[model samples]
Target: MRGVFLLLGLVGLCNASVLTVNDEIHMRSKRSSESEMTRIRNMSPSDRPNCQPGVTPPKIQVDTTERLSDLRNRFTAAGIHGYLVPSEDAHQSEYPSNYDLRREFISGMSGSAGRAVVLQNKAALWADGRYFLQAEDELDCHWILMKLGEEGVPTVTEWIEANLMDGQSFGVNTYLIKNVEWDEMSKDLAKKGITLKGVTPDLIDQIWTSGRPDQPNSPINALPLKYSGKSWQDKINNMHVAMAEKEADIMIVTGLDETAWLFNLRASDIDYNPFFLSYAIVNRAANTTILYIKSATSKLTASPTDAATTETVQQHLNTGASGSCSGRTGMCVTVKEYSNQQLQNDISSAVSTTTGYVWVSFGCSRAVYSSITAERVIQDNTPIALQKAQKNTVEQQGMRNSHIRDAVALIKFMAKLEKEVKEGKHWTEVKAAADLKKHRMAVKDNRGLSFSTIAGSGSNGAVIHYFPTNDTDKDITTSDMLLLDSGGQYLDGTTDVTRTFHFGTPTAYEKECYTRVLMGHVDFADVVIVGGTFGREIDSIARRPLWDVGLQYRHGTGHGIGMYLSVHEGPGRISLSHSSFISDEPLNEFQFFSDEPGYYEDGQFGIRLENIVMVKKATTKYQFPGTTFLTFETVTMVPYEPHLIVKELLSQQEVNWINAYHKTVQDTIGPLLADDALAASWLSARTKHMTLENETGSGNQQTAFLSLVAFAFVTHFIL
Candidate 1:
């Protein structure tokens, strides 16, 4: 998942000079204002550089004293005892722009997920297991690190209740709080006699006056019909059908990805995610659609590169020859400035026109929820999420095509890296990640990285979402376990894959752990589920193998992926979590998601194997009435590390599955790598037939040869 960061300048010590500290500060500020400040305000239509994952931003220092003091002053002025800073933007987006990173700025923790509370006397940051080590490395002593899900660590609400005094007000930005979150917290705090106030103009915003980046205002373009598979008009018609079924007169679309998908639009407002900041309103009774966006038509027309895109969108919406949708002859989308005032007025008007119910997702912001009458608003998961999760015919084909190309790039990188490490040529994790991206970019239809590359080596692999930064980079060695989790965004589709590799011989314990993880992955992929079964019902299949040995990983087994859209999609997931709305969605055909299971030993090594699998109809021996069977089609064509597997531990069924999958990999991706001999050889070596035989067999001999190669390299380095 993508996170947020602030673009503040790096604070460095100044040597002996004629300039005073104040003078130096003034000069640096002037320079920043002249260049960086101007660029932020006047952004071009082109996409900004992709974010560097794992690498700390310039502002990630071990000190937050000055910033905390400023925020405390604001809390005092607002007459609130404490303030809560969440990790979402006004749109409830998971991957917010750099401008909306108040939580990171005040707490000094940059992981994608976390919550922070600041009182005049004490401050604490709550992070989950994935970020515990990262939080320890980044946060200073001024803040207490509360590891979430730990036995003694309390949740954010529980912590607030324990810390705050009775009748004291705790402030939060209502625009950033989801309706469900606000409702639950308000009720919970009211029982404790604590006032949960909805504060305007966030307290952090008041204090972060300088050095904060400007809000994103990128160009909007239409996704081609070939890529989208369905027209925007057809998608809206489907929405109308769902709306009619729900008895909804008006529907509010607040999720950024939902809006982008609804209009067949794409933008670079947020990195990695091809989404723009906008709101949509759909009226089934009135046959009206409205899109609220910043500088709506002006920004689209300003860029010559977007001329065709603007025309396509205008025609697709039926705006007519006038190039606008004001009092048009046919039904069309009306574009308006994206502002809170304008949106609230429109919502009020829509609600006023409808005696029927207004539909909105429970994830909608409290600010939007407050404008509607309580009796008329119906809150549930948005219908568009389910519709998007199931891909159409064209999208399914594109996913397969793009993944083949993606495999070509990944296999090339793996082969080259393995060869280098065997020859004793050192490569840093950052450099290796860059080389992988170079290969991905050379492929056709590549847009950019789906997310920051997770290229962790040795001890770094224990960090689940480890990103290699200049400060934490490690050299690739034969003795280290390297975990590479990365993805690419193509014009056709989106992909996410994780593969763990060891260039040298592994201990028996390591081999056993890897085999168990592989067993889970194979089992989850091969199981046939009954129709209407929820994801949680089947999630344990991926973890049962590990659980048998009293070992389990901390993260979810899988999450939904979009086609050239958000990588971490929702309303469908495979996890043990009982609280999330997405966890309850039933397994359906045409749905694509990941199947990843792993085991990690803290400060030693980590092992995870992942592939994107598609849900499809399964042929069963017997069919019961009103019951349908479904299985998965693994689209990712990369081969697993052959040497890491303990073949004797696998059942014949599991062994057959591995052999079949490797054969498919060679058959599908083998021809594409014909031009690259080294990569072809590497693929052939790894994908060879596996058997539960003795160690002196042909497959084991090949493994021994590779080990000898690594040993020679290590011995040469020693000399």
Candidate 2:
């Protein structure tokens, strides 16, 4: 059996190596770069420490057929008809580490995106385009592979509808699923006469003993009040008030961010999401109990003493003579010390024994717990999510200040790139990317990059969500198009921006494509539809021009932006498809969305124009109307190649928008730049004025006239 498994593993490796010459060249070039070494070194010290004791890599033991048989047996014994396995945790991280490896453990597929549904007789795994090849190769042939986000492929909900029998129950681990997701699933299944079950026992851990790692218990350290701009007591008091309004006996907070925000704390327990593994229960009357691993103190203790001391003293100190702290009177306890499982059991027992109702807040973990019984957990946008989104006065000001600081660094980087590369000084994509990060770090209070920096040159830029790796040996040449999508996290706020440019004079096709993409971007920004849905808005604005030319991008036009949290936030977004699983559907007015539209030519180059827009209310006589109003804040400071912009392709409106946007960038960022950068900004700002005919042509002869007509038509109808 062992020999057979080894042979299969070797076969897979051999198959992976059967690549084209281009692939070999790309792979070899990537292996030779020093940037790759820098990336490995840059990871958290624990991931690759210098003096850590070496541990053997976990052995991969494949029991192909037996594993499936065992799962089927468990389903029968537990009275569960089926199980749903999602790829992400509470935070939808595309590339999750070992901590969130449930999907991989069950199906043996390692695609960054995918989900699985296991039934007694069969199973299926669903993935999107990027993972089709990888998923097919890694998953068992017998397990069905469903292509996701495409026509003809049923969604997980649709599949459940078809397979679930009346009165049948499906199991899911509550800790792994979010509240919004569970609510949608439960409502859909209920309509089909099927019940969604939350399995108390984590079946995945039982079957896969070797894959699960121990949960890290680092102490929760306080984020500076200057950064968070709120005291822990205030946040907790607010939660208590929200709980009272909802009439919930207790609000169960499961998401790490919610816990961190409530406690005014931060941790490196999870990458990107600065949160520790913890849970909390806040009663309507303001009483509270915290469930957390005991081991966290060691890590939390290492944080700055001033911040830690502030939190510890606040937690234990009495707020006043009333003998209560803030609005609530509560106690904090460790999960291991308090025994969460036992506490939950007691709550269940009390509910059944008494006639009173049980009210709890729902998130991914809490939602799963709600699914376990017949009790209905009222689902709503978490108080923390709402409070966090409507930034306080200080937070809003912080965001504005952060963008200005970030813009200065970006302007300098862009100016230097053009200067150095134009003089025949060659630079690799990796080096350019590193330079951007270094520049961002130079800002005072800048923590790090909000996400990975994408610096793609030429054909590589066309991979819309392209993340450059060391193996990406592409060079920034004078003839190539370049796309740099990046952002930074500061003590003040988070930022994300993308700018595509030409190193030198671009081809006619490139000019046309860039202009069309820009047109789509501006159209979306200028839209003033009242009560418009994102699905309808994106289809007509971003996709129309591309559709007219038989061109389109595979990705969404926009996604919701976070304050200083996740870059791709939710409850608000602009996309063609309706995602029922996320809360706060039908994005409210004043919400932020990225107005990005692009065209990708598989082997040549990609063009994208992105700007963040906020929904706002338009004033009118005897009425108040809402519309998607955009502000080209220019969080990203970079120059578009004037020589590559086909002025003839742009309408008068588009030309005006472009000129105005650049002017705003210059005005906002000019004073912050150093001497050399200020000079470069002056030069770049003037480039926007250059025209195809060296004259401002009449609207009748220019494309801007056509755009004006369209804009007028849209405004007339919407207003």
Candidate 3:
């Protein structure tokens, strides 16, 4: 078997014109024993992240005096009238490393989504509705807040054009901006005879020279074939086919997740994201592969010590060659230092030798796109993204299993929380969040959190992307609505689930809003679509219930979810806005997305129900030629809060759907909670069947009886 795989791997590299997929790579996962499960359940939480008080970033005001003066000096030296600062790294990552947080460092706006532009005299920040309140609180009086999506508010480009003169030049770090964004801005500015120059060294880095954090140099580890479900050799062969179809001689993988997925690797360079800062270049005709990283000589081990070494990673990649690809055996790789100079030199050599074009994603850095000849560059979405979005059979199963484990932890936390709140125990939002994290860390195969947990109480829940801090933490009381949006990154898959709870009685308005949101979520999950339907066309299905009441949320309805990778993947999303480039892509089978429909009242409370669902083929009575029907199969098994539901508002069909969904949750997660008596009782009560006639009754009246049954079972085991 080893020899057969070796031959197929060699064919992938040695003969790119006739590359073949290496299907001989074995993919399997080890099942956990009952003893292991019990041991993991009793594990300590002291070693986890959220269990302890987290360090907070200092409230350092954005110094317009020293920082702006220093940046303006650089602009003068670079011969530009203004400079643009984006909140993204060279990889266009959503959560960039501290070293690449130039926008936050310069503007003091730490929100993830925003753009900063600074001229000699004036500066401004552009942010969406989610961060309007946050941006106002963070940015100093020196900066103008340009609220995005508001009527009559100019866009970043329009604002730039309005500020600059015809003969002036505006500058940006080409290595930090997306290629498509750069193209659009350049063309728009050029019409007014304004120059948009590509600055080599970023101005913010120059200003932040004194106390800037160092770049990440974490360990780069291999993801086992059991978890990845595909060998890197097979993935590269698929890439070769994609390149051949595009008639490109070289393909550049710039996105961090793209590189990690292509190579079957994982790292912790970015917070909450299992990814490293890296780039890859594959020359098909030359049969050469090069991985660029900060420390090429560093040891490569399987994360958390799974017995993989540098040599194993090399073997898995079939990487072994001294210099040239003249007589390379398999997919030989050359590890090189990560720098723009080296990347440019290698791209020049590849373009000089081949007559074919160079394949690069439009999501790639503008600097990378500019390195190749304009006509020879094929700019589009990377094929790896589409491939990664569509999970394999192994990955799909892993997602299901991970969500079950996640549900066990969440149920335990909710049970304990409801008990404590009823007993008048004091709990802060931060403490409750930590308790949830502690429970999650005790689950088997758990790695870490997928993102920071959003634990908002009362009015804080109204803030869509709210994160509680020490200064802003509020007590989570029974009278308030608690919105918890959180996720975990397990070894097998990623899990993101959100549920709003009301320990006390909710008002009629609150119940109505929650039920409306629930209705939207159910509608979205139940809708069947044609094969080639775009997410934008059907996004209204999730918002119709809210729209009928003239209430809406500012954010998108759903986003693509990654498998043990980035929580936010790309190429497909469920959003109504046309501003997003990925919203138009067709949804495909095996693709996972968050079916989250929400409604937020600015001062009172917020209601959102989120479930990570997989797109699957739907059974239809009739089949159309050249088309397929699709529907959602929800993988998140956590039940909704019965206290906040208004049964009177639910239709018969909706009531039946909710009942069926709760039954599925109990059937799936009940066995896993056999040992945790408290969690088992909670799950049973939460999943109790509901009917329209039971509008005013408490659905969990049987909780006391279930708890007694669980206690008897535990006592029998003790005897």
Candidate 4:
């Protein structure tokens, strides 16, 4: 629900930047490294997921002509005229597994985001500006590369309108399309006499039976109440309260995070994310909550069902008891262990059995709705998201506690890198990432990394999401800037922190850039939002300093972060840009976000400073009566690298902010480490404030006494 970019909204019209160009367009690329694979292999067998979602597989050379020919056969067999393959899994995830790379499997374009439209006669693929260069490099001659967000380059819908004839049949897998999206597209297409067909048992799957990766059925781990901060029963109660307010009889939750949060469970089914695939349906009035998880989940714990009355899938399929929801006691917690198509069939039966109104969240797909026998479908965006986004006191404290451990791990890794580099020892990006991840996992209740460690060095740092492979990995050198943007998945909370450092003495320009970026980050972090300040309204504070210097970052200044859930969890964000995900709302208390602002000089270096902070009610002296004020509570306890910062550029106020934040980091993380350890020394040295020439006298002070006297004297003499 959070990660997937816009599918095909092609509006910001401009002259097209054709992909087939002589000049190489600078872009970000994600690569899986050798050390990472070794780490994966070294992990315990139980920890190994069937498919590593984060691992960037080698460039797949898909024969477009051959694949198109095969697809056309299926299209002919199914009597389908056209099909749309998006980079979407059944859950509509941002990064689907290799098993679900249907778009890449057919199109031969391997950008993280893109869509392919295939017709019997012609086929085309579309990518936004981010992948224009990549598309040119990866796309074969068989597919027409359409540059999205360009002038005269129509959106998928626009292309369909301009090209396709009336009375044509267009098909898509219903599971990959949300009900809302399908309804909108169907209505829009129907106007032109186009029939939108809902295809089941994916057409791609039909063609891709040869070497599809195994579906994940990883064992489920129960998230203890200490980590979760609430029992599943209590969470259910909260959902029921929202359901009552919505006046919906039944609520369907499909988002992975939503499901994971609803039912206190975690797994390694998806890479980086500790989540298991599942569906949750809760009835407000009936007080029944049905959790349909994999068979592997059943093996994780004893069947939470009465063995005497428990009906297996075989029994359900044989008889018409397809909707059996077996419970542990006389409670409403029904755990239906299933595999393969059982989840779909069981969900269909479960929702259809209800004669009352069915509430589907934003994440619910058209496939789920197609089989429903409910009287009505209510557009009920899951309230559990906002509920979970605003962490409770326990979760807040957990986050603070978790970051302390994470800070220690990071300090050790960074210190190790500094020592190695200073001693003229060679270190690679892969080694750096592996070493950091290793330290992270050694902490208490550490699952693994929150995401792939973004350990970029020198020119590599310029690539915002640059993940190193053996081929592209850079060696750590004194003359390069290392941007270590990494996080940990601790049981207490999730951690995301970025600190850019230069191993060698930085140039004047580099110091200025780093300080300016740091200034922007602190400015945004220190903002006290008064009277319903939406995140978008206050986004400029992070960019003003960068803008003043004619520099800007491509990505958003800040994004919402989840506690022990998704690193980029949403429903709210601190961004000026509007998308399908960013909803306009007041910045609420306990909501966390990574306050990061950066500058990137292509083929040179990138600098970004990020710290996760929780929103809290601001106790301001001056505020409009009857209005609320909000501020941020620093949660990420890591220290900033002082070497790269030009302290002379910082104002007294900025210097104070750094000193205060460093003190907090020291106070929180200092005790967590051993007394005689290298980490403690490193932390102390890293956080130690740089002494400016003067607190009262500094650069660019126009309102100085001399200036004021000169102005006054000049005016008096003139008079």
Report the lDDT of model 3 for residue 70.
85
- Candidate 4 vs. true structure, TM-score: 0.81
| lDDT (Cα, tens digit) per residue for candidate 4, span 1-719 | 11211211121110010011101111111222445434322322122121135644334334567777888899866767889887767765655566778988888776556778887766777765445544654565556666644543444554454455687888999988767667766776687688788887788888876767887776565666777888777888888787777677788777787888877667677777777777777887677777667773334343323222233322311211333445334344555664436656755766655666677766567777666676677754578878988998889999988988888888888877888889999899999999888989888868788877878898778766666667668898999888888998877788989999988899888898998899888877776665455555555567666776787665556667777887877666665444342234556888888888887787799888889899998887777778777788888888888877777767666778889999988887888777537778889987776566787635453233234323323332332
Relative to the unseen true structure, what is the C-alpha lDDT of residue 350 in candidate 4, on a scale of 0 to 100?
Answer: 64
Q: Better model by TM-score, 1 or 3?
A: 1
Q: Order the candidate numbers by lDDT, best to worst.
A: 1, 3, 4, 2
Lowest lDDT block of 10, candidate 4: 13-22
- How far in Å is the alpha carbon of 613 misplaced in model 4? 1.0
**Best prediction by TM-score:** 1
Model 3 misplaced regions, further than 4 Å: 1-65, 300-311, 320-328, 580-584, 693-719
Give the poorly placed runs of model 4, Cα more than 4 Å off.
1-69, 80-82, 107-112, 119-153, 191-194, 296-330, 338-356, 373-376, 580-585, 675-677, 691-719
- Write the number of the candidate with greater TM-score, choosing between 1 and 4: 1
TM accuracy, model 1: 0.87
Q: Best lDDT goes to which candidate?
A: 1
Candidate scoring better on TM-score of 2 and 3: 3
Q: What is the TM-score (0 to 1) of candidate 3?
A: 0.85
- lDDT (C-alpha, whole model) for all candidates: 0.76, 0.58, 0.74, 0.68
